[model samples]
Target: MSTSSEHTFTSPFRNFSREEWKRLNGQLSHSIREEDLDQLHALNEPLTMQEIEEVYIPLAHLLELHISKFQELHASSNEFFKRNHQKLPFIIGIAGSVAVGKSTTARVLKKVLALLPSKPKVELVTTDGFLYPNKELIKRDILNRKGFPESYDTKKILRFLADIKSGKSQVTVPLYSHLEYDVLPNEKLVISQPDVLIVEGINVLQVNSRKNGVFVSDFFDYSIYVDADEKNIVSWYINRFESLRATAFQNSASYFHKYANLTTEESLAMAINIWNEINKPNLHQNILPTRYRADLILKKSAQHFVKRIKVRKI
Candidate 1:
């Protein structure tokens, strides 16, 4: 593992106003239309088009812009070195706290980016696949901290990214099960020559892969951190838990089947317990610390609508 202290960003960013965002990303928003809003099961509630225009659509354009700029940089470098050219992979990382609508953002981004004629082949691989199996987490006495950075196979994730970024024709990403609460056997997602790769997780931009080690983010061409207040995120988490109690958790195969039998009061308490005991702490110590490291931060409100956007100033 190498320290990220040695790595540096390649461009500047600005916190644009809604009007400014429209001017800069308007063309992209039109070019890459996100007609169907993907469902983020964790959201606990239904989504609206307001979220799409204000948050996801603008985000798609911003991402598309960066991808093109990064591609140009590749060509620029090739010309500068007087070498034959090839298309370098463009990687985009989307990071956020638990229940912050990041999964939905990732899904919508995947669909929207695929709309681009210039870069129709986009791949999305979640960090969920990198999570340690339930048995491993239990052995390590960290099952409660599943979404924390330490729960992921960071080294393997880095290797996968490095391989694909290096122009390897095929890269296989593991699959994880929501019902079993572990990585699935004999199930993997394969990617090849992707024009854009969207990596979504709670700590994608966190630089501390180890005390001193290279982060998976080192390979990202751009990054977005979905953010909201602690109270709001906690509320969302609780609501989601209750919703799942009536839906997914009711499945007999669900590891959280016990939650389905709980009263609304009990379910809320359990969700908050999980948050306070595990998710919130992970956010404070590991995830939120990386927010500033992202190329852009999409700030949301209590209602889950994106309220503001912060782009890192060069």
Candidate 2:
């Protein structure tokens, strides 16, 4: 028998094959250029216009439908209360294993959703900014557990989400640098009442016990979990590490610059070790457990193309 991780299309989700999903694209055309896509995707992940047409077009339409409904409901609530409050930004949370392309998904969605007829102001932020600084992690001795749930400042994250949800203006979020592998000092992203906000991170869907019973996923209007086999994810992680070694790691300022001069075999071994010791266990223990919690799951093939979509049934 297949396990839950196998995603055999059990209850609560309506599963669609790639062909079925693509048929829902329904003549929608986007103006995204090839050069624009190059800047959107992550290293080692290739996103083509064809994939955008087949997968993201329909997905964007679906989100617009949800957004429209949300607007209607908000107006109705205001009518009932005889009060007109500012509309809160719709928050979307995207979660998946590292190197599984969740960032690419979030970026593409942000672009597509913003280009819709409504032309709503859309913004994207990653929860990496919420992680404790490397210094604090080292002080706490959880630097090795960087991506784990405990490494994040949950209280601060909750406050940020709460502020945004309350329709606060000019909320500031910390900035993190992938090149330096740390939260940048004194730099922040200021959000000012955007129409939509996309929060992407592996830990977005995580639900550890809290005193006030608030969780990060609680603020999400919609959530997506990028899904793939553990073996495929492991392969992708290794390949990404190898690619980084040749590129980003060679930079003197890169945190992993020490691995830049390693031989091919040595680099491969190091990638395997990091995946086995760090990313793999975190996937199984923290990330994978939250998969089903997502409202939608974008299941991908070994080639990194989305092959199937499972959307929660209303």
Global local distance difference test of model 1: 0.79
RMSD of each predicted structure: 6.1, 3.5
Model 2 over residues 84-200: C-alpha lDDT tens digits? 888988899999999999999999999999888888899998999989999999999999999999999889888999999888988999999999999998999999999999999
lDDT of each: 0.79, 0.91
Per-residue CA lDDT of candidate 1, range 1-314, in tens?
A: 87786686555556666555544443332443233443432445456665555566667776777878888888898899998656767888999898888887777678667765464688888999998888899999988788877788888898898898778889999998988778997899999888988999887887776434677888898888988898888888888888788999999999899788999888878988888898888889998999888888877778776767888774
lDDT score for residue 76 of model 1: 92
- What global local distance difference test value does model 2 have? 0.91
Report the number of the highest-TM-score candidate: 2
lDDT of 1 at 201: 88
In model 2, state the lDDT of residue 145. 92
